[model samples]
Target: MPDRDPLIRVTAMPADTNPYGGVFGGWLMSQMALGAGSLASRVGKGKAVVVSATDFAFPGAMAVGDELSVYCEIAATGTTSLTITAEGIARERNGEATVKVAQGTFKFVLLDENDRPREVAL
Candidate 1:
């Protein structure tokens, strides 16, 4: 795992909450996917498709006032695919410390304009 900056950061909003008022797991997963996809696309130098989510774990809960951030970096590059690890962390609005909420490793394959697989640049 290499050191890199966060890929996406957004506040927990009411719209993203479940009936229990906590952030939804599916919503968090989507954000993680988007973050990983963005990094993979940039590395692939084109669009990419999520082939698989290797590992996904939720270690903490998220609330409305939490500041959530998704950090991602390239883990490996295949002939036509790139793998990235994404982590989600949340910090309380009143605190500076952040807690890891969830993490997952996703594989993305480069795609052409017609949504077909293409050889990645790297």
Candidate 2:
């Protein structure tokens, strides 16, 4: 487990599995995006939308019933954008085993009420 608290944490349900019965990579990516977006919005003090996502890698696998925790941090900040790095860790369903399952970087642009890009608050 990480020393810091996760931005989002949830259990991998059977519905989140792929055809092979393993947790779906898309589901993991979505979880990471949710975490990154949350951080971006909080730091920007307004809406933030993903502009780009890259460097995705699945280093491990998780099964249904495992607990998934997504951790995110702002890696960089621009005038109107935030670069967030997100990592997903999976804990065994019935044990203490944990592994880094996924990681990626997401770029989010702060948006105003009209949904146009706006400068970040800080």
Candidate 3:
């Protein structure tokens, strides 16, 4: 876990697993997207949508009952966009052990009420 609070946290359920009975990678990536999107919107102070997602990696595995926590941080900023990095950590169901499961970078463009790209205040 990070020193700061996680942007998103949830437990893996049976439905979130693959046919092999392991937690699905897509599910983890979606959680990372949600976390990165939250930070983008909060920092942009308006609507923000992902333009691209890249550099995704899965370094560990988790079971259905494991808990997942996603942490995000701004990595860079552009005139109208933000690049955020997200990390996923999984904790054992009934223990304190934790391991990093996934990581990715997402680029987003801030949007105005018209849904057009707008300058980021940063």
Q: For model 2, which pairs clash?
A: none
- Tens-digit lDDT track for model 3 on 1-122? 56789999999999999999999999999999999999999999989999999999999999989999999999999999999999999999999899999999999999999999999996
Query: By summed lDDT, which 10 consecutive residues of candidate 1 come out lowest?
Result: 1-10
Candidate ordering by lDDT (highest first): 2, 3, 1
How many clashes show up in model 1?
Answer: 0
- TM-score per candidate, chains pooled: 0.90, 0.98, 0.97
Tell me which residue pairs clash in candidate 3: none
After aligning candidate 3 to the native by TM-score, how far in Å is the CA of 80 from where it should be? 0.6
lDDT (10s digit) by residue, model 1, range 6-108: 7888888889998888899888899999898888878888889898996899999988878888998889888888989889998887787778888999999
**lDDT, residue 112, model 2:** 92
Candidate with better TM-score, 1 vs 2: 2
User: Residue 51 lDDT in model 1?
Assistant: 87
